[model samples]
Target chain A: MTVQARSLVQITAPRQTGPTLLDRMRRSSLLMAILAPLAILIVWECLTRVGLLDQRFFPAPSSIIVSLFALVESGRVFIDAAWTIGRMLVGFVFGAVPGIVFGIMLGLSPTVRAFLQPVIAALYPVPKIALFPLIMMIFGIGEASKWAIVAIAVFFQVFYSTLAGVVNIDRIYLDVASNFKATRWQLCRTIAIPGALPFIFTGCQLGIGMALVIVVIAENFGTQVGLGYLIWQSWQVFEVRDMFVYLLMVSLLGYGSQMAILRLQRAVIPWKKDDAG
Target chain B: MSSDPSTTLDRTGLSPPAFPKIRVRGLGKRFQVGKAWVEAIKAIDLDVQAGEFICIVGPSGCGKTTLLRILADLEAPTEGEVTIEQSDPSNPLSSMIFQESSILPWMSIRRNVAYGLELRGVPAAEIDKSVDRFLALTGLDRFADAYPHQLSGGMKQRASVARAFANNPEILLMDEPFAALDEQNKALLQEELLRIWSETRKTVIFITHSIDEALVLGDRVIVMSRRPGRLKTEFKIDFPRPRRVYDLKANPEFGRIGREIWTLLREEVVGP
Candidate 1:
């Protein structure tokens, strides 16, 4: 009977076709997103060229592009971008790994949650950048202090998000796992982590944005070789075009990191594709 | 029907005939709603034979789900006990199919069907073979690679049912598994389930609110009273095996049993 049914299903099932060109274009939202920003840049360029706006504050898009090219030719852009990316990566890894671990621990154990909740709640809202002087005293105003500030900023975001994710896992899924007689380790591996992952991804995305913001602010104090310092240095020297160049780099860095995280989410949670459709 | 209903014995009054598959003795459950403790099931006593299909029909909030949950060992009974005779040590005693399609949304149809066996540390080759067999049985072979969200509600429930059957559990506990489906899908699934049940002969405890559903699918239908659910009545259905759900609806005996069970159920629903 099963064999007969299998053959019947195969014969009756519709053939899957390759996506058409219009379907492919519709699926790629990134192309549409680029248009809006491109339009804004064009309008900004026209306004600056025709003297509708002050050139001192708002440099022409063409002049900013030229300065961007000049920075690239000097190889300073590469150095600054690498430094900024390295600090963000290092800080994010250091903060997020432990944050997720501790968050899971806290989420699963009410006792641990009771002991740690008050402390986390107290420190979570304090702007981490305000603690720069204190961190600088402890780590001595080098890359360590900047790294510390960025890590602290990222830690809270990942921790709270992960905690929320773990706590909010549907009880029915857990009941299903237990009913199947899954061991604790198997439950965690198969059910808990996969169930909590969407929210955890949201946390990581938010952490990345926070990390970029804090790293830039942290660089303002001690660093001489990052995009943040480049922006500040250009401003001190009264070079509007150079400042705009650094600002554009910062924007690109933020955009690039966000896209990277989004790509990771897609690869890991492939089932989410149907949710959009 | 040629079968005799009188041959079936009520567990409350008579001892089970040798080696019952499941035994529930004075089972009860109570939940704390706010400050007060509310009794869900005051007591339930039942003995299920090997390969018997038992359907439980009850009013809403009658703790039918709670009873099923206790049998699945998903919840602890506040009082009494449930014991399952482990006929096979290799297979799990029971696998439950929930009211909602509990197929993990992250897993593809094939993987969802393979989940229970995989969790039991069954080898990959065996899982593949079993998954293939059950998927074909459920007519879901064409959708093996599709995720739960990609499938329709009926297909999702079919995948979940396939998952339970593929595990080859000794007993299947289903809590209103087809209640959310449309009429056509529900009837189609019921027939598919009967075919699967006949082939496997696994002891089944199916919970439902519909008397017609109970009459069509079960070898015996057990009715329960309202809140603090207690076993009120049991009817031995004499419907022959290999019965089609649609055909059963037209049977005069089916309507007779449905009306009898509905009268028992309506009292709990309408009060007094």
Candidate 2:
């Protein structure tokens, strides 16, 4: 049979109506976000005041916010955050660029992959922090050492994800490419890079997460200008409130950076199924 | 329209061609499942003239796909020789419209349609012209800027068809491109495909399990046996040109041919 003629669009736009409760909440997502954290902080502050929690270890949230503001006013938070973020970005750029480059190379060529896979496999399992002392021996305890540790830590995550992404691209797509008689260079440019991009972003996200962990630990050793330095410094001086403030800043950085990456992923790969706006 | 199979040769050129457009002799594929060699297809011989629409129909897992792949140069046949006579050096040898999810999801409809041409490094102006024409022809012009994820399954396959046509390859190889669609979509696409194909009679090798689809689309419907497939029967469909699928099936001869194919295939499908 044949001659079936009609529209292809299965999904029609829903009828618009007055804003429901769910719609209202979705519209005020930013407001909702602020309210939940603020309410939690207020409850914690009240609990501290009532002596329900130990004031020594668990300072009032209000006092911590005050210290946070004071730290901001003194520009200490900015300096520390700037240092930490700067190192993370530098390390991320160096590590991620090479990781993706090598990922594409190894994914495409089995000869090189077979030769180097064992080396990569053996090296990836070792804790990155354990390599820091070895890194310090080479770069010394300074910005170079911090940068090296962060970059090295991030490289593994990005490389693994990029490799997996490229290798696991649907066979049909590659078959399509091959039918068109694409050159190896054309294959990489047209298919491998774009196809592996979603996975590369996944790697970058994990890389950034690890970057934060490594940066804080590396700062604990050599630098006095980062959030990690402030954290360790606060512990030594017993400035519990300052410790809470800096620790809060660390968490904010982690959350903020992850959100920034998600935003970047949305911008870069707007065609991702669930991620499409 | 010449219904004669002999007249199908050399439609592109004024003079008759010295050779067939495609030559496949004793083609066989063996897949290794663990340590054992699994015979996917065995000792297949086929010849397709230029500008001919040939459809191969068989039961599922009959290795028709593997045969199509070998012709497309995506897979190598272990036993025999396969050659595509490329008349023009500039045009690609073959372009395949896959069963599903063949079009790149990351690209917009326009870009996906233009992908093959872009890979071949054709001039941008020519690429744009062909792409625009095929997009509109496929009813995807309105959604030229839309990505594959935004389109329906049928629409995505339409884009894949558009891509193959836009590339203007010498031979078109399709592996059950409509197998994933619903009946309505399948009919619609079938009509559209026949219309497009009539306009440009590129040598086409279509593989499908649907006997009706084969009869409706092809000048010759080839039937193959089960796994480790070998060609069993060949029927020349002498339906006159511009035959619509809806009207053609109503003919008593159409039922006769379909039943003949079903009978030939039943033994292979039912075992012994």
Candidate 3:
């Protein structure tokens, strides 16, 4: 009977050890995500070393890294990155804050929505980058014009997203507020703003990316301090390695900004569970 | 049908006031659905005594919710008026509890409970005390800091109830508050509601479709007919106070009253 009981215990409870390989892999998924790019870099380095690709156009990964390091050490990278980031942030703030405010107004008042809808429809579809010449005429071919271009690009994105956000708030919440005798201001403060937060974060994410893109395009003309100017200068001189370095920096900056925005969203709106995970 | 004077007097305590807590005179509601106007309710007249628990029961789409909404001042009646007699100038006339979860999703359970008091500009210390009291009463003290999304459906509804009670409204208007809860949770909430109602003695106007629920909770059960709803019948339930919801249903008197209401309700449900 004792022997039978021991066998049953073994069947009921398997001997415990540690996490399985799959569990460990899942835990270190971020490392696996980095591994793919590292493997690609290694293969590209091997291919270049073997002389399978021409060195003139496609420089080795090691040489590109060396160029990157030299660019950073020269202090030019900081100036260019600062210029780009500053332009994006200044333009983004000016554009997005007003956009969100006006969006909320339009969403809450049907009269305002009706009055602005036609004008918004007319202006929203026109590519904001294409307005750079007109903006240059008004603000001059300086930082003002670049800021205008970036701001216009970001404004429409944020405005539309915020409007959609406020408009989509469940009517039930408003009714509940009304039942509690909430004033108009109280309704906006307590119900409307918090309810529309998720969508506003989405708008911010989109607006930032658009601001980055417009800044690059704006810098391509009459700008010398930004990463866009560096890329343009490199391409003009046919320095492919330097151009690639700038491109990589731009990509990294975009990725980093997006991740930062996502982190902010997670922190501010912890109630929104990420079901995708 | 109008309320009986003797029952209203008994519920309102000694030296009953000249006016009822709520007086509805020819209350009617019509909605403009698409192009045509749909009559949701027609000429509802009700006089609810102070400290009375009244349950309004009807078939689906019979405008019981519309009537409750009108009483809570959430909706304007197409015709007629609702007058709430507020004795205290400082207190709000009414607070509503919806059928679905109405606790603010972004707010913690404690914040949601404290919201009404905050809106009323109550002192911070008083708000915190009332919030704590109601949270403990509803058995949600442990989840005070948790967001609504982190709570179960029943707990969220409990938070909603606690919020209304903490506001200390003169009248509580509930529209099928437990309609979405399961049988077990419904029983638990019903008991909690009874306990709270007995202690507070605030005038309650509850709307529900369940006959058993109406019999278990209401001092008087008001039945209404189909769309363009009108009062069909009223049953004065005299179930003793400090009632156990679970045991109430098993009582033979509970079944007899429930069946009588159901019989009156069946004709309205079946048409003509």
Candidate 3 residue-wise lDDT, B84-110, digit = tens: 777676777789999988988888899
Give model 2's DockQ, 2 decimals: 0.65
Clashing residue pairs, backbone N/CA/C < 3 A, model 2: none
lDDT tens readout by residue for model 2, B171-220: 99999999999999998999899889988889999999999999999999
Scanning candidate 1 chain B in windows of ten residues, the lowest lDDT window is B1-10
Instruction: Give the local distance difference test score of model 2.
Output: 0.89
Give the best candidate by TM-score: 3
Q: Is candidate 2 or candidate 3 better by DockQ?
A: 2
Q: What is the lDDT of residue B176 in candidate 1?
A: 95
Span of ten consecutive residues with least summed lDDT in model 1 chain A: A1-10
Lowest summed lDDT window (length 10), candidate 3 chain B: B5-14
Best by DockQ: 2
Which numbered prediction scores highest in lDDT against the true structure? Answer: 2
Per-residue C-alpha lDDT of model 1 across residues B1-272, encoded as one tens digit per residue: 00433322122323346958888888899999999999999879998998999999999999999999888877778888776777666888689999987888878899889999999999999999999999999999999999988899999999989999999997999999999999999999999999998899999999999888888899999999999999999999998888888788898888888888888888899987
Off by over 4 Å in 2: A1-36, B1-18
Candidates ranked by TM-score: 3, 2, 1
Q: lDDT per residue, candidate 1, A1-277, as tens digits?
A: 3444444333566878999998988778897778788999999999988999899999889888998798889997898999999999999988888788777778767899999999999998898989989999999989888888888888888899889988998887888898888987788788877887888888899999999998987888877889998888888999999988888889999989988988898889988854341
What is the TM-score (0 to 1) of candidate 2? 0.90
